[model samples]
Target: MTQTYSTDWDIEKYRDDTEPEEHWELRKAFMEAHKGNFSEEYLVALARTFTNIEFMGCSYPAAVMRRIAELSKDVAKTYRENKKTKLQRTFVSASNAAENKIKKRQSDPGVLPAARN
Candidate 1:
């Protein structure tokens, strides 16, 4: 008699077992072997790989992970700066409108605050 197994279950087990497990070790070895002669392409690729592995809940060396985190933070800083510029422009426009309203009030002496009495 032959036993039948679910295709989905088999595929899931294959994926879990076949997924790359040596990414961090390989990356660490590469960096160590080429410490002083690191290239930009290598750094970018390493950082991207490290980031991906981290997102996948894999473990990596602290120092190497820190470097990758720093690069990621730099990217985040650039994004925040761009966002801040847009927000600043919006605030300036609003400030100008408020100033204009105050000027109009000041120029028209007929507009006055309610008396306390």
Candidate 2:
């Protein structure tokens, strides 16, 4: 009689067994992939992955994670400032348009123009 075993296996166990050098390689690849401006979610996911790398005894450096956090703060600050500026411009444009409309009504050729005092 022949006994068969299940093909399914635990991937987490294999991931945990990865060498420290492999973690460093992965970290380098991650950084390269996100070399330019990135979103908060992407930064967060990279940080989280590195945190796990450390937890797994993969020897990924802690300083990289700190840098990522700092970059995240800067990205958020810039985003907020840009949003505020855009909002201010929209409000100013709308106010100017409304004022122009009022002036046109005041000087309407259809209705008699305002009399000089």
TM-score for all models, in order of appearance? 0.27, 0.22
lDDT of 1 by residue, 61-113 (tens): 89867776665554344434665666343345888988887788777767565
Model 2 score (lDDT) = 0.49
Worst 10-residue lDDT window for candidate 2 reads 6-15
Q: How many backbone clashes can be found in candidate 2?
A: 0
lDDT of 2 by residue, 1-117 (tens): 544333233223323344575454444444444444444345435744654543353444678656655544533344346646763423468889888888888787676555422
Stretches of candidate 1 off by over 4 Å are 1-41, 76-117
lDDT of each: 0.49, 0.49
For residue 103, give model 2's deviation from the true position in Å. Answer: 99
Clash-forming residue pairs, model 2 = none
Give the Å shift of residue 46 in candidate 2. 1.9
